[model samples]
Target: MWVCLVVSVALIVARLALRKVRGQKITHGDYWCLCAAVSIVGRLLANHFLLIYGSTRILSAERRIELLKPGFEVQASEIITGSKLVLATRSLLICVLWSLKMAVLDLLARLIMKMPYERKLLYVFWTALFLTYLASIIPVFVGCHPFKKNWQIHPYPGDCVIGNVWLFTYEVSNILTDILLMAVPFSLILSVRIPGMQRLRLLFLFSIGIFLIAVSIMRIVQGHNSRVQSAHTLWASLEILFAVIVAVTPTLYALVRNRHENTTYDKSHLSMGATARTHPGSLAEGDRYAARVWTELNDSASRTDTTSIEGILVERRYETSDVKL
Candidate 1:
């Protein structure tokens, strides 16, 4: 996750710096991605701590806990560690997931910001997501009858029935949200009359959200496996990590597209130079023009200003949703 975070931060910084040079307003989407990077770092640290403490449970009660009987034993330390891991996982997962969704969604918002109806729909989407995030997190803090029931060991005054139902519901919601986010961008793209290659790239980028849905399903299937808490934490981190990868892909693609455009421009200029050299009277003039052209190209290519490099990305012909703002 942190790897993803670092790459994203680097890209966004490059993007913002380029935009600044071009005198373009740095969009909210850039800030959203930055926030997502920070959230990824937070999740990584929390999960790292979780893995260290949770892995301590690898020892059976005999070694790690006080053995009181052949069938049953108790360890206060293990219980405390278990409680911390559970609470940490429960609380932090939502934050990581929410940040990931917001990052992806905000990018879409920037892409389609000029479309009034769609932008309003995004407002609705953000509100619903915020509400869902709250709903999902509130229960972890307040669901238990006495609150301590959340981490209480076995031998409750009565039977201690663990709630697998909520777990399944949470997984389903995660899958549903991933699907929703994936659909929005693709649905909008479908209406645009872009060239086939650009359309394919857009589809590919948005389709990455499917991986998040797959990870959510796997997480549900792996529920409550006590044998390896570290494995569980690893898999959970991957859900957000997968999103980080998808979120960074489009920005990186812009850089690639910019390079391709530069190559094309240089080739065209070289062809013009060759044509000029073909005429005897124009040879000297052509040589000077070509020299000047080469100098300009070299200067522009050497510039690290991200916006001018990626200007074509902002002006892609298929941005039917574009507004002046």
Candidate 2:
């Protein structure tokens, strides 16, 4: 989870920096922001998993009794509550939040870059997928008892008996979602009418998603093992760490690439502080607002033609999200 925390911080800093440069305010499109916040939550969940596991590892019956004393109850209850929160968070983020963000990213690409795809189709598909997964969690929610069991004794009840079936569904769906999301961006980017060599180069770079594929696989293995070991166990902790890193790395790369090139607001093709006049007959207000925001946000994004560096000569069309000044 420490890895997640570190990467989460980096994603936030980078996202904030890029937003500042573009002069764009936060919108739902800023999925990395959500990722960062969710990651911290994931860490909290992971930490609780560790606490419960440690509590279980005490060899002596007397020590176990001592650990469960009234004074320690408060802390133990907190740990159990944290674990439940983690499970809930993991489910919501994996099934709903992250999926929505992916769809939004696709929608943004289509809006900003004229990416061609049935946007409605993609959105509907993802929305359905998310809702189905969320629906599956109802069983777990219904199973949670307020004060029936003695998983741990804090003033409040613990979530020890709640089976991890919900967690398992979340993990499996998350792995699938990661692959689909990673693959979809590449598809959208590659479908653009760019030169073959240029397209190949872009795909090669974006194959970085393959790295995330590896992370997802590892997460599935670790998370599945973690369910039996209490929410605060070590194996579970590793799963959280893996998730944080996976979520943060892409954002970090985008941020680092932006910074290394010293792309500032003024140097971009679209001038900073320029507003796109609202076209009465154009797309919805949300689209127009997003466009205006993006243009302002990327004001300092590297406008330099990267063909020279990538060793591919190609024509470029620089369309940006139009941001109102």
Candidate 3:
């Protein structure tokens, strides 16, 4: 998770630099990616605290007794029990997920053909994401009588929502959002005619949504059956990492493109190879050669500012009108 977060930040910075050098304005997607990065860092902070003071740790007898007291006066600041730890984790994870979602959605809005009818539908989809964010978060606070009661070391079950109900709602909605974000864009991708390889790349990028769903499903399975706190924490962190990865992946491919573009050796050899492979019955090689050259040419074609940032890897306008949507 930490590695993914670091890579995400690095890519965002590099992408922004690329945009600046090209004299393009920073975009909504970029802003959302920045927000996503911040939320991811926030999630990491929550994860660190979970490892140190969350349910996974062994508590002292004295500490346990102190926490269990009726008049102990526990507040949100304290993290003595499992409830507080889980609450904080849930809250932060939801924020991270939604920030990434908005980033991705904004980027897609630019890429997907912008017909008024389609735009209305897209707006509706964006609203759904926002509502999903609310559904995942609002309950974390209000599930208990007093919001602080959620994290308090109550003697027994206080006036809180049933655990089963909370879990089912949160998990189902989360899973639903995960599925929708990935599945809805299929038609849009198919709408724009592109080359086989680029189409494949887009499909692969969209497939990250499937991975997100898989992780979410795994989390549900692990959460339902596992009794170990450590294992639970690990699963939770893994999900967050996957979310960050999906969010950052769109802009990331450009880095690979940039490396090939910047390498004098590769460019020189590519030209030499292109000339050598220009024989009859070498149509396949010609296409491959053309693809590489097109990638380079395409990179130079984008006159607008489109920094690589956004979730679902669905940001950056056309990734130079060819490497992206």
Instruction: Give each model's whole-structure lDDT.
Output: 0.54, 0.44, 0.55
- The candidate with the higher TM-score, 1 or 3, is 3
The candidate scoring highest on TM-score is 3
Q: What lDDT tens digits, residue by residue, belong to model 1 across residues 173-211?
A: 777777777776777556544456656666777788888
How high a TM-score does candidate 2 get?
0.55
Name the runs in model 2 displaced over 4 angstroms. 24-27, 31-35, 38-117, 132-140, 143-163, 189-197, 225-325
Alpha-carbon RMSD, each predicted model:
11.6, 9.4, 10.5
- Compute each candidate's TM-score over C-alphas: 0.64, 0.55, 0.66
lDDT string, candidate 3, 189-308, tens digits? 554434566667667876787777787777777666343556665665666667666665765554444443234323323443323333332234323322111112123222122322
Ranking by TM-score: 3, 1, 2
Candidate 2 per-residue C-alpha lDDT over 23-87 given as tens digits, one digit per residue, 9 for 90 to 100 = 55454445645654655566455555544544322223555456567687666555456545545
Q: After superposing candidate 1, which stretches have Cα over 4 Å from the reference?
A: 1-26, 55-75, 154-166, 224-227, 255-325
lDDT of 1: 0.54
Clashes of 1: 1
- State which candidate, 1 or 2, has the greater TM-score: 1
Query: Residue 247 error for model 1, in Å?
Result: 1.9
